[model samples]
Target: MSFRSEPFLWIHLAGLAVLPLFLELTWLGLAIAESLVPVWLELILLAIVGIVPIAWMQWQKPFDIFSLLFVALQPQQLTSQQRQILRLFKTRKHRVLTLFAVLAMGWALWKLAVFAPLAAPAAARLTQSRGLGLGLAIVGFLGSNLFLQVPISVLGVLLTSNGQFEVTEPLTPEEVSQSVTVLGFRVGNILPTVASNNL
Candidate 1:
C-alpha cells in the first residue's frame, strides 16, 4: 500500500512512540502491542462515525446562520464588560468546572491504566479468533463511552461563559440613583417584623 493511501499511518506510528505514556507504571505496562491494531482501527472508525452527524448538521445550515443562532440565544447581550468576562473565562480555569472535569478524566485514565495489563492477553487472544474478536469489540465499544465524557464537559464550560454582560454600557446618573434607592428599600425590608410575630 502506498504511504499516501494510509490516512493514519503517521498517527499510528506516533501512537507507537507514545504508547509508553499509557504504560507509565512499569509493572502494569504489559501491552500486547500487536493487539492494538483492532483497537486503533476502532478508534478511527468511531471518529468518522461521530463526525458525520456534526458535519451533516453544519452542512444543513450555513455556518453564519449557526453563528447567528448562537448569538441570539446567548444568555447576555454583547457589551464591553461581557467581552472582557469572556476573555477571562476562556483563559482562566472556571475552578468548579475544571475540578470536576479533571477528577472525572483522571479517574478514567487511571482505570484505563489499571485494566491495560489484564486487557493485553485478551486482546491477543481476540486477534486470532473471530468470536473473541466480536466480544473484544463489544468491550471496546463500551469502553469508548468513558472516553467521551471529558470532551462533552469541556464543551459545556465553553458555552456557559459566551461573554455578554449589562455592565459594559454606561448608565445615566439618574438611573444609578434610582437603582440605589430601590436597593436600599429592598435591603431595609429584611428585618424581622415584631407585629407579625405577636399576631
Candidate 2:
C-alpha cells in the first residue's frame, strides 16, 4: 500500500497482463498458418503457443486458483444469500474498446466462417498471392480474442473477487441493498451485498 511497494505491484500486474496478449497473438498466428502447412507442424506450434503461458501462469498464480477451486467444489456452510452476494461484483465496461472489439470480431468471423465457406472453390481464382488465406485467418483469430477480452477480464474479476471481503455500492449502501421497484412492482435488488467491514 505504500509508495515504495507500488513499483513492484505494477511490475507484477504488467507481467500478468502480458500473458493473455501472448496467447491472443499465438492463436492468431496459428489461425493464419492453418491452411499453409502440414498437420504436424501446426500441432507443434500450437503446443508451444499454449503450453508456455500456462507454465508461466502456474508460476505466477500457483496456489490461489487451486485453493479457490477446492473451496468452491466441496459443500460448505456458505449461506444462499452469501453465494448471491458474490455475483454483485462485475467488471466495468469500456464503451470504445467494446465497440472496436465487436467491429473487429464481426469482420473477422465474416471473412473466416461465412466467406471462406462460400468461397472455397473460387479461392484459387480470387487470391492473387499465396499468403492471403493465412493473413485472413490470422486476423480472424486475433479478432476473436479482441472481442473476447472484456468477457475474459470480467471472469478474472469475478474469480479474484471471490477471495476478497469488500463489496462496492454504486450509489449508496442503503439504496443498493433495497429491492428495486419497477413501475410500482418490486422486481429485485440491483445486486446482493456482502459484509461491509473491509469497505
Candidate 3:
C-alpha cells in the first residue's frame, strides 16, 4: 500500500520524521523503529534511518542539551536560575551521552570487525531468492546505516570531543531563537516563555 493510504503507515512515517527528538539520550527513534519491524529487516531499515541524524546529533554537540534548554526556558516556566541549572544539566547530559556513545562505538566496532565479516556473508546466502533478498537487503541497509553510519559519526564526535579534531560549535542565538519559535509552534503555550525568549 502507498504510505499515505494506510493510516498506520502514515503514523509510522510521521514517527520517523520526529525520531530525532527522541534521540535525546539513546537513539529512541531508531530503537522504536527497530522494535516495530522484524529482526530480519532490522538492519536494513535501521541503516537507512541512521546516518544523517546521528551526524546531526554529534555535529550539533548538544542536541539533548538544547532540548533541555528549550524545556526549561519555554515555561517562564522556570526562573532564569532554573534555566541556568537546566543548561548545566544539559551540558552534563551531553557529556554523559558523549561518554556512552564513545564506549558504544568502541564496543560495536570491535564486534563488527570480528563478526560483521561473517554475518554479512551468511545473511547474503539466506537471502538467495531475489524477492527475499530484496527485502533482506533493505533490512541490511537499515541495519548498516544504523550501526555503521552512526558509529562512524560517533567516532567523529569522539575525535572532536577528545581534541584530536575540531567540531562545529553549538547553535548560535539566532538559530536558538528560530528553534524556540519552532518548538512553541509544535508544543503550545506552556512554553510561552521560551517563545518569548526567542523574540
Candidate 4:
C-alpha cells in the first residue's frame, strides 16, 4: 500500500477485529434500557447513526474513499481520463452534511441517555447498571463508526459502482515505474487468482 493508504488499512483491520465486541456492548446497553425505550427504536437510531455519515461521505467523495481500501496512485500520477472519473466524485456542497450526521449521532446517544437515566437496576446487581450500559453503548457506537465506517463506506461505494471504477492488479516494480495505474492492491488478493485472471 502507498503511504497514504497504510493508516486506513490498519483502521479497517482493527475495526474488523473489534466489531463483535462493539456489537455485544451495544446489545447489552439496549438490554439495560429495554424497559425505558423499545429495543427496536434504539436499533433504528443506531442504524441511522451508522449509515448517515457513510452516505454523506459517499456523496462528498466517492472515488476518494476507495483509497481507504486500495492502493491508488496520487492525483498527479493519474491520466486526464482517470482524474476526470475521480473528479466526478467531488461535490460542490459544503461540509455541513458530514457535520450534521455526526451531530445527529451525538444527539441520538444523548437522547438515549436522557430517556433512560443511569441507575442500578433493583432486581439484578450485575446485570442492571443503566449507567454502565448506556456508557458502553455510546462507546460501542462511536468506536464502530470511528474505526469501521470508512472502510465499510468504501466497500459500499465500490459495490454500487457496477464496475464504473477500475481496479488493476498488483503492479510489478517495472510496470510501476513506467505506467500509471488507477487503483491497485499492494499485497494480498482482492479476488481469487483464477477469478482475477479471468477478469
Give the Cα-based TM-score of candidate 3 against the true structure. Answer: 0.31
Better of 3 and 4 by TM-score: 4
| Model 1 Cα lDDT, one tens digit per residue, 1-199 | 2211221222222333332332232112223343455645643443344333333222232111101111221212222332333232222343343345334533544455446667665455434543444344334433333223223323333344323322223333333322211111212112134212321
Clashes of each: 0, 0, 17, 0
- lDDT values for all models: 0.32, 0.33, 0.34, 0.45
- Cα lDDT of model 2 by residue, 1-199, tens digit: 1121212122323443553454344334333322556644543443334333333322222211101211321113222333232223222322333344445444444443323434444454444443655444444344334225334333333344433424433323233233211112222221124112211
Model 3 accuracy (lDDT, Cα) = 0.34
Point out the higher-scoring one by TM-score: 1 or 3: 3
The candidate that wins on TM-score is: 4
Question: Candidate 4 versus the native: TM-score?
Answer: 0.39
Candidate 2, overall lDDT?
0.33
Sorting all predicted structures by TM-score, with the top scorer first, yields 4, 3, 2, 1
lDDT by residue for model 3 (83-114), tens: 33223323434455545654554344334323
Higher-TM-score candidate among 1 and 2?
2
Local lDDT at 47 for model 3? 38
In angstroms, give how far residue 91 of model 4 lies from its true place: 11
Q: RMSD in angstroms, all models?
A: 19.6, 15.6, 14.5, 10.7
TM-score of each: 0.26, 0.28, 0.31, 0.39
